[model samples]
Target: MVSIDEVARAAGVSTATVSRALSGRGQVSAGTRSRVLDTAAALGYVVSAPASSLASGRARNIGVLLPVVDRWYFSTVLAGIASGLQSAGYDITLYALTEDPTERAVVFETFLRRRRVDGVIAIAMSLDTAEADRLAALGMPVVALGAEHRQLPSLAVDDIAVAKLATAHLTDLGHRELAHIGILHDVDDGTEREHIPSLRRRGFEQALDAAGIPRTSARHEHGDFTIEGGHAAAMRLLTGDAPPTAIFAASDEMAFGALIAARDLGLSVPGELSVVGVDGHELSGFFGLTTVDQFPHDQGLRAAREVLAALDEPAPPTTPETGPAGLDPLPFDLVVRTSTRPPRRES
Candidate 1:
């Protein structure tokens, strides 16, 4: 295997300089850094984790713990994190804990505690106090994405406020009877069933109450966070005796399903019922669903950056504080389209 020394010799720089250049740390001149990188690339030189750790006291990799790899939001966030970490000269190790208790235990108790990564970035998983304690015991910096952790630094949007914003948009259109389609996930994944749905539901209720509309239990239905689930739930809701004039889905996928349900029921969208969704999914524009754009990709990028920042510190805090991590809330914009309008009177 091509060693760092060989690359350093080929680039006419010292081994220390090669390390600095390849790691993008310390004081390496741009010209020398470029030369070292070019030589290493040409020689197929891969950095030795053991050697690098000996020198820098860090593994130069970050662990990204996610609930599922197949989901769109998770994958998009992972892409952003990977991009940001790569730019910062760090490697990412992905761990998917798909609701298996044993696997989750192994990951938290063994793999994470093994010092394989300098820090961790948990996406969309709400760590319980025990899990948070385990991570804290590892003495590495940890940052959470899409969920708040008062005991550790976290980056997330205020879900409740976003829900209120979405619901308010429909109410402003003079929608008196509105319905909400929410996702029901396992509590372990820390979304939908964990906190997002409840917070969003509360926000929806608050918005309706503020508008002097009665918040009835009949207006809500829970389903998985998939388009099919939304479709099924919405079909049932719309077919009921009292159909709502507007539907506020917690996610774009669900909103798409609501649209499908509306079509299947022979209802004219925005004429018979208006629909709104959250998450700004890429396909929202194609369907023309009015939505609250919560930049998930940007959220991932910010979470990765926070991990890098903690890694860069001279001495990371051993005891994680239960306080705001000073991360800015990602901006949200309401994208209006043909899917939403004021209620039309029946002829």
Candidate 2:
């Protein structure tokens, strides 16, 4: 098999020059770098991660923690992080914290403490005070994805503003009766699922108030962030005595369920009821659902970059700060589609 030494010999360069050129680090003449790369590619030479890590005294790996891997949003973010890290010559180790609290404890108490990774990126999993402290005490750089930590850096979207924009979109379309389907978790989704709901719910109510529409308890229902849950919730809401003219699902998956529910009830989309959702899910375009695009993949990429920066510095916190810690709120865009339109008047 071809090796770095062979590539260096063939390229007529020293081993140090070959290393610098192949790794794209240090200074090397452009001509020499090109020759080394051509020689290595022709010989099918591959760089050894272990050797590189050993030489640099760094693992060259980043640890990513996610509550669940099957979820679309989290998995999309993970993919973005993986792609970004891979492009930057870093490897990823994923730690899935299922519903087991003990496993989560082990991750915080032991796995992260082992110093096996240069940095840690957490996705949507809110670390408790103790867990945050324990990880912080490790002194490794930490970046939170989609959730904010006071001590760590994070990337996410403004949930309240997203809700307001979605609600306002429906209100502007002449829909006075509207409903919101949001996640209700027994445990928080780690990003103020507990607090964000209240804020977004308030935003929804505020939009209604501004439009001179009365806020009613009947207009609110909580889903489990799943299509089936959304279908069930929307089924109940739509079948009620006074059905809403439009529905704003907190996520595209739920909005998809609502779409299905609308179909099952013999209702015509936009003609009978309008639907909107957040989280620019890939399928949203296919489903023709109007939505607020939160760009979760970009959030993950930004969070990974932040983690890399923190790992490069590893600074200590000195002062108490106000507001959400580690929170880098990403932007959102309202994407209109065929799913939403003016409320229909009785023919």
Candidate 3:
């Protein structure tokens, strides 16, 4: 491998001058910096990360905390973070926190304190007061995605708005009796309940209430936010004596399941059962499912930008919010498709 010293020699500059030019850290004349850069590019010279870190007192690596990596939303958001951070010249290290409290304690208390990363970006993981305190004590920049922390900066899609938009789409199609497939709010895993699901469920209810729909006509069923879970929940709703004219699922995956359930029961979509969902999943277009698009990938991009900004500005800028930064709300839109329409009158 070509060394920086070789590039410095080729550029007729000192090693220190080459280092300053390459790292963009110290004072180097514009002409010398440009010449050194050109020589380094020609020589394929690369700086060692450890050496750079030692010199700058920055690891130049970001730790990303995730609850799980298997889901579509999580994976897409991660992809965005990886791409953004890579372009910004930073390495990424993933820290998956399980539901096990013991393991979480080890990660937050031990691993994170090792000075391995300059900052952190947490995705959809609930942090307790103690955990938040520990992160704050790290004195590293922290950004959150898809969840909230009173002490950290965050970027997330408004789940309630997503649900309300989905519900409103069906209602606008002239569907009176509506059913919702969402995650059960009361589920306990020895931590705080997920705020997204509860807010979505409330949004669904609020839309119905605003429409002046009777409480008895507003049907609801809990799902695991998976296709299978949605299928099961949808089966129950579709098989009822007085089935709803339309259904609003909390996620596109669940909406797909509801569509499958409707098909199995020989119900013609838009004629008997109109289905709508949140998240503009890739499969939504194939299935022609109407939905509210909450760009998860974009959320990741914004979250990465926020963390990078915090890292650059180390001192927390004075914001009107209580946290180091405020919540950035992503935009959502109702995408109309073939799966939703006015309910057909019984012949």
Candidate 4:
């Protein structure tokens, strides 16, 4: 009996394409589909299943694991993933994961082992050794975003550097008194290196220290990465004695909240208060807030494409797990707007 891989190689396409072409369940150009048909007939290849199920050697679907569904950044990334997968004639099976040990194990051991998906894409949800072992055992492609996994490929932004850039912007503008708004420990991959909020905070402090400023002289507050949380944090910072001249929010939502807090306090932006944030949120320009644009949606698309491209390649033999290569860095940039400027002279 000939294998699906043989037919795919002879047809000059991926097994997924062969499955799609044979099952007529996914997008395939008429010419390519015809060619696949001719090649299969010539090779005496026969379809084991009609609807491209696991028996067909391709599921025409991918599993997407996410840490959160409600947040803007996550939602945006999910949309991009969905868009990329759909355009490629594939569907997605969504899984929302948590810290629950049993639940996590069920996903990796049971649900995924069922093999309904051709591959897996995990966004902002890190997998540990056991979990990575289980996934690796599945013999399918896996891609991670935001959260990095040592055993598998990952794409993530340099959070520490992103934060450093945001903070450095404020410092470069001659703003000495700085405040940072973001709660620590939002998400921790097994490495602890990808812990989002904590990394940003470390970046903030690093930037301050580099500027010959005492770390203790700067203010730190928990913003929960939300508008309300940011507003409350900023309110406390702005209302207190000797408030900061600049605020660097870990996220754009929090930065918007800071902007609101400044307005409510009757502080003139770029004069009495300057605020910057990470994440190039849609409203960043509308609010005139400077930010680091990490391109979350593009990040999602890239992750999706990584898994898809992997599908078209032959499976590599199992090898020893590579040690601590570190997470792959995604691109980011500092987007300056009207929200920041050198503080006006008191004289």
Candidate 5:
């Protein structure tokens, strides 16, 4: 019912000053900004996004790309990004890159190229060299989350190191016969084992080697990064002739599955089989699961910060932090709980 002009008239400020104050963009004195805001609030006046875009040459919207929106990691990161962007007065446009290659192609070739957003933040999607070039060609700042891109600003944890730490925790607890539940694309879930999962597998193997434990093929199972997948994998391993004393799941979801499977098999946790996982999943505490806490939400916040900084600067954005062994790997911690302990002595 009201407009910017009415608010500007009430506040005794120019329309441009009202715009600057409302958008928090250009120079406006504190007193003027306060008055303008009060007037706009009193008058129920709202700034038009289209008009603002036309005037500032910015959409004030950031595009976010994710492989799947249903997963815990993806959803949690999105929540963080949403809160951070809202506080900074920016909007978000989400693009869910489906499993189909054609669908993903459409997102990059069409959706992202529409010139509607000022920046992009992609989460753990396997963007190849060509895809990365296409994103860069958009001429907008792009930041990658949970994966490293040499050309884009990124935030990622050292998956290999985190995995090794999880495995080492089990080994230090006298888990000589240990197994790992990891992601494998050949499975029904069609999970990808390119970046984080693959790196974690390598770390698991390295830890086993360092502990002088044999890295047997029998000790590995592809869980597809899901609780159900981990349950199935644990079912098979636990029923085997020589079951492992402990299991290291690449993700907390899988570890939760392993815990369930152990319980189903009448095996006592930490007493019969120790389990450990990565990701500080919300349910981890309730489950009393020992885990490596990779703060996905924080990664989202950092990625948003990087995008905002790039958008504010006149120059090109700074190079992103790479991972697996970055100069500064994203923060992570090993949380010990009831799920893991030194393997029970063989009577």
Candidate 6:
């Protein structure tokens, strides 16, 4: 690797000048900075991360916290984040957290304190008062995605409204007997309020109530936001007595499963049962499923931009609502497709 000393000599400037020009930290004449940059590029003199950190007191790294890595939504968001952060010349340290209390304690109290990261981006994780306190104590910019957090700035969709829009679509299509997959029963994913399924369930129930359909009358089955889970849950719903005319699944994956179950039971989609789901999964169009498109990749990009702005980095600035107490509502839309239509009139 070429050293900074060689580049400084070639550029006819001091190493301090080269450092300032590359780091963008101190004042240097434009002509000198340009020359130093050209020379550094020519010599392939990349600054050492440790040396730069020691000098600037910055890690130039962001830590990402995730609950599950195997899921489609989480993976897509992570891809967007990685692209944005890497483009900004920053490295990322991924932190995979589990449900174990001891492990979480170590992360917030011990691992984070090691100063390995300059800031944190938490994706869809519920934080208790204690966890929130520990994060605040870190004195680093923290941004969360797909969550409603009081202590941290978040980029989240109004899930309740999103669900209402989806449910209303079915009701407007003249479907009354509707089944909801992915909500209803008591589930413990740390905090129900912060959990996506619980919030969506609230919206689903609210929409049913507004349609003059008693929440009690509506059919429901629980799916764990996976295709397999959706398949099993949907199979049960379809096999039961007086099966619903339409089903509103909380996720596109579940909706896919519902479609499969409908096929297995020899039911024609839209002719007998229509289905709708959440998340603008890539496979949604292929499956011809009407869904609410939440744009998970865009969410990730916005999240990374928010974190960079918080760190006062030279990234594209977001709106004023990115303050510590702000809750920036992300965008979502309902996409109509072949899987959803008015139920056929009963003969």
How does each model score on TM-score?
0.90, 0.90, 0.93, 0.83, 0.92, 0.93
| Residue 79 of model 5, lDDT score | 90
Q: lDDT tens digits, residues 1-347, model 5?
A: 78888888999988889999998888999999999998898888877889989988889899999988999999999998988888887899999887787987898999888889999999997777667767867888787888876666568888999999999999898889899899753323322235788889889999988898888742888888889999999999999879988999999999999999999999999899999999999999999999999898888888888788878863344433431122246899999999998888867
lDDT value, residue 53 of candidate 2: 73
Q: After superposition, how far is residue 14 of candidate 1 from its true place, in Å?
A: 2.5
Sliding window of 10 residues with minimal summed lDDT for model 4:
318-327
**Candidate 2 structure quality by residue, lDDT tens digits, 84-200:** 898887889889977677988888888877777889888876677666666666667777777666656667677778888999999999998888888543455443334545556
Give candidate 4 regions above 4 Å deviation: 1-50, 185-194, 314-328
Candidate 1 regions exceeding 4 Å error are 41-44, 183-194, 314-326
| Candidate 3 residue lDDT tens string, 216-306 | 6789999888899999999999998788899999889999999999999999997888999888888899999998988878877888887
Top candidate, metric lDDT: 6
- Against the true structure, candidate 4 has what lDDT? 0.86
Among residues 3 or more apart in sequence or in different chains, the pairs in candidate 3 whose N, CA or C atoms overlap within 3 Å are none
Give me the candidate number with maximum TM-score: 3
Local accuracy of candidate 4 as per-residue lDDT tens digits, 1-347: 77788988998999989878877768999998999989988988866543346445777789988877899999999888998998876889988888898988888878998878989988887667667767666788888788666666778898999999999999989989999999855554454344788889999999998898899999998888899999999999999989999999999999999999999989999889999999999899999999999999999899888888888873455554563334458999999899999988798
Candidate 3 lowest-lDDT run of ten: 316-325
Better of 1 and 4 by lDDT: 4
Predict model 2's lDDT versus the native.
0.82
Clashing residue pairs, candidate 2? 149-325, 150-325
Relative to the true structure, candidate 2 reaches a TM of 0.90
The TM-score, computed over Cα atoms with residue i paired to residue i, of candidate 4 is: 0.83
Query: RMSD to the native, candidate 3?
Result: 2.3
**What is the alpha-carbon lDDT for the whole of candidate 5?**
0.86
lDDT per residue for candidate 1 within 1-347, as digits (tens), equals 99888998899989989999987779988888889988999999998878888888888899999988988889889888988999877899989875677888999999998898999998878677777667666778888788776666667788889999999999899989899899543355432234777777778889998888987633888867789989998998899978998999988899999999999999999999999999989899999999999888888888888888777772335344534344677678889989999998777
In model 5, which runs have C-alpha deviations exceeding 4 angstroms?
Answer: 184-194, 314-328
**What TM-score does model 3 achieve against the real structure?**
0.93
